[model samples]
Target: MTASPSKLAILTFAYVSLCVQFIFTVGFNHQVHHSNFRPSPTIRLRATTQVRYIQIRPGAQFKIALFADLHFGEAASTEWGPLQDENSIKVMNTVLDDETPDFVIYLGDVITANNIPIANASLYWDQAISPTRNRGIPWASVFGNHDDAPFQWPMEWFSPPGIPEVHCPATSSAHSGEEECSFKGTGRLELIRNEIKHNVLSFSGNGPRDLWPSVSNYVLQISSSHDPRSPVAYLYFLDSGGGTYPEVISSAQVEWFQKKSQEINPNSSVPEVIFWHIPSKAYKKVAPKFLIHKPCVGSINKESVAVQEAETGIMKLLVKRPSVKAIFVGHNHGLDWCCPYKKLWLCFARHTGYGGYGNWSRGARILEITGQPFTFRSWIRMEDGDVHSEVVFS
Candidate 1:
């Protein structure tokens, strides 16, 4: 069937417009921030990869607020009642207003997929990050096991046959009642990567592309002085991977860390604070575990994650790094503690979201780093504005 001349002209114009829009989007993918509003300086890694890194040098002391287990999609009990989503934004702005941290790290489990349909997922994620964006504080993230779980859910007549696939490989191992994973609904990574592209507010990695199809793994150097080359501490955000990859960290990631650590701190010990969603088996070894917030101080009252069958080698590599000082994780909502283990400290962040399954009071783990003598101190910022677990790194 041949189209009329007018129809043909309209089709041609539409095609051209679509092409131009795509070109513009790709061109501006690395340019979410507008000119004249420079935030942090971007630096290249010591490794051969082309990943972008952020150098944070907030003068004498830098405060980092860690929010974990913020499951944003859980619905409220009453129909059309106040959504549990409100809790996440509340915690974010409340903490930001109180502490004014230089950087905020979301320790994963940003959303709960089972309660949220696959299509409206991005809205939850965008809303969840409102506080950071509104305040203009630079932030980063690591995905919890639940972030992308909606993708694994079963598809229930996902789309009309002629609609074409909105999300590629529409289903994951995470099946339950035929609802397929789609960025509009199930793909957590899609929403997060778009945010990461902003660069102005988020330092979420564009890295370890070799690891999995996830955006959460990378090493960011916090410079000591003005020069990005002179780094003081490194922040390693690792993807624990069970949702998209594996529950355990891979040897390749370990090797990448070794390369990056040596590259950044080639000589003296430049400390590093690790952040991830799930904790390793080693976290269980930390002494005096807790089910709630405790007054932990220097090797006391540290909580451990429940034991899980995990692969090895990443922890060994971490221990070998003279610069690596403490590891911070968030998965189990009830446990919040920090303790010394094997010359390094293993810490647990409190569950800071209302949407998750825990009844524990919501709060964030706050880290205050000082550059002068290279000291690290952390405590919990509770929902009621009370701080707990003030521990200086031993």
Candidate 2:
């Protein structure tokens, strides 16, 4: 018996619907696959349900690898720029594989914002930390002068047939959803917010509301491996001002530090280390006069210390606290030495990114801290897997 016209029509509609669904599914998957090749700064990865704690392993030392001045996305429009970024990644991977650090610290200048034409600098920021995140190694970040600098157009772009017109995605009905393809670079707040929201493994914080403009001014406590409840050491990250503001630690920041240090670590009991981008005026006071030898151990010292605009009370406060064993920074690409200053040591991270101006070899500064006797040691791990410039400060 042949089916009625209505039944026949219904059957045809069902068959077409199935075909359409199949096509839609395949197309959606294809789009996703291609997108993985491009930078997805906001993409969320597999994160632990609970916050992971940075701890010293039992009967073992806690090791941290510091990669500074990565300058990711610098000269992104040019050929040489991308190549430099690739080399920077190789350096990070090499050091990570060799040392297998428990934690990674992006000392600063993670992205050269002035060189990036795109409105969102997070694309480069994501790239800088991907190496650590990929390996399931927990990490933290502090911003640098170049991280949120105002966009600077290339001189050549203004030449020739004048500035070329560009188009970006926009709303179909209204201007509600549109892409901003402007020279305005992403600021410190947006960059830090994006990082903390997407990556649970990231221990970075936006600090306090009072400390506006300086978003990265928080403290991280490394718990004792034996006792998770007890903190063995503390790591303080300061937003040594730069980029959109004066390149100096503000007096307000000094006040915040004083209060936070007392609250978290009163009586100067716990061993603490500080990390920031720009060197303070105190660094200049202790810098090697002629040769970087004896008390100071490092490979390169070709340039003078690029001190901050002015000397705030941060250095003086740090000097008073004997618990503050050492402070690390990475603004000067040409210098990487640890000199004794008062009660603590002042060190510069080896230039780890190829995008920055420097012909010297690329490497990261490796720091190891033992919990039992409380010994802090540092050294440089080059891209070629060579290690040198070892120093100990207990």
Candidate 3:
């Protein structure tokens, strides 16, 4: 009953075709299911149209601006919060007008709410980012805990057309059933279909991945477009999420950061800076008892422990990695600076938007770094485009 050779060959071919078809069907189904649950798009910033290359001659200097904790909708009707936004925008535009930097790094919390309307979120993004766009300066950002609150949709929803949408699982309950939340709308997830355009770096997930964990941590590595001889600088933007109140750096981010440290050139003699929403360590030394909350106040011990553990874990990581020289942060509404660890400067810039406790000194920080014994100088903005506090770092 053996089959003929020709018949046997045909039967084998048919079996192989059926297996291929089955595999294709299974893969397609998996992709379809994943998309249905998380439909966010990826958005990337575009390069500045007027990119001017400047060579970093010996004794050359470069400037960068850092601002965070905008909390746009914090006091929607109050003149204080909205006025802060207006003042911040004016100060940023003035900085661009005064001293043009290679680029700017906006530490996150661009929007205040976890569940704010997409239109309102888009308006804030547009208003806050318009200064840079109009100046043709590029900027990068990391998420703040407030930025990742269950209410605010992914930042990519606001990206203009032609950029890919950034996607993440609906891990939080606030945005559970939504297919995708973006800064830009009109229903399509693909960036190519949108008309909005701006340059920024945003990723999926509520916070930074474990590999580079600090807060809502990320790396912004940039080289002088004009100077081939300029030493490259790496800006490690961390995501502290909110404040020490409820820390947000997860265990996953810590593991990711350790691996990432190995990639940095410890011996290259180049300067690296770290930025985060919350300061890694407080500027003033408070008593250990102050760090602990009283149970009589109905405070949960576990919550306090989590904050201490998360902060300590990140500090341990920073101490082990010397390439991280300076850390910039803003959470406290006032300006302060401290040296948390040897060779590591922790600088807390004042909040540009929304004053706290009647501290009406609304301002932004402008940082200038140079090679050959790296240094930095911070400038603060005051009323009517007046900037002061030009403190130099050695």
TM-score of 1: 0.75
Best by TM-score: 2
Winner on lDDT between 2 and 3 is 2
Residue 61 accuracy (lDDT) in model 1: 71
Best by lDDT: 2
> Cα RMSDs of all predictions?
10.1, 13.7, 18.6
- Kindly list the per-residue Cα lDDT of model 2 for residues 1-394, writing each as its tens digit: 2222211110001110111111112101112122112211111221231223465656667889999999988887778888898899899989988887778899989999878766667877887787776665667999899999876666655525444334343445332222333344588999999988877568897888888658799887776767654667888999987889678888888999899888777889889999999999888988998788788889899999998898769999999998999999999999999999988999999999998898899999999888766778999999998999999986
- Distance from true location, Cα of 31 in model 3, Å: 43
- Model 1 C-alpha lDDT per residue in residues 180-293, reported as the tens digit of each score: 332333565676676666444566865656766445778776766466556567788887765545677767677777787676567637788888778888876654644433
Please give the lDDT score for candidate 1: 0.64
In angstroms, the error of model 3 at 68 is 2.5
- Model 1 CA deviation exceeding 4 Å by range: 1-59, 76-82, 151-185, 287-304
Q: Give the lowest summed-lDDT range of ten residues in model 2.
A: 10-19
Clash counts per candidate, in order, are: 13, 0, 37
Residues 95-199, model 3: lDDT tens digits: 666656545666666656443334234445556665655444445665555543434233433335423234423547344222333322211111111112323
TM-score of each: 0.75, 0.84, 0.60
lDDT of each: 0.64, 0.77, 0.46
Instruction: Rank the candidate models, highest lDDT first.
Output: 2, 1, 3
| Clash tally for model 2 | 0
